[model samples]
Target: RHDKLAVNYMAMVKLAMIQQHLRAISPSDRT
Candidate 1:
């Protein structure tokens, strides 16, 4: 369904955003 796809897409986007935020705040965590 289109609505379900949209919800999944939003969730993925939010997850990516949080990941980016964490990475930006802690660059030394990659090790």
Candidate 2:
């Protein structure tokens, strides 16, 4: 159970990082 939770946490963290990177890049692309 602990291992599963850790995997989920890591996945979420990676997803958040990707989302933040996309958001950062998108604005530059618009202009």
- lDDT by residue (4-31, candidate 2, tens digit) is 9999999999999998899897877666
Off by over 4 Å in 1: none
Please provide, for model 1 over 1-31, each residue's C-alpha lDDT reduced to its tens digit, 9 standing for 90 to 100.
6999999999999999999999999999978
Q: Pick the candidate with the highest lDDT.
A: 1
lDDT (Cα atoms) of all candidates against the true structure? 0.97, 0.92
Query: What would you estimate as the lDDT of candidate 1?
Result: 0.97
| Residue 14, candidate 1: C-alpha displacement in angstroms | 0.5
Q: Name the regions of candidate 2 deviating beyond 4 angstroms.
A: 28-31
Q: In candidate 2, residue 9 scores what lDDT?
A: 97
Each prediction's TM-score versus the true structure: 0.79, 0.77
Q: Which ten residues in a row have the lowest lDDT in candidate 1?
A: 22-31
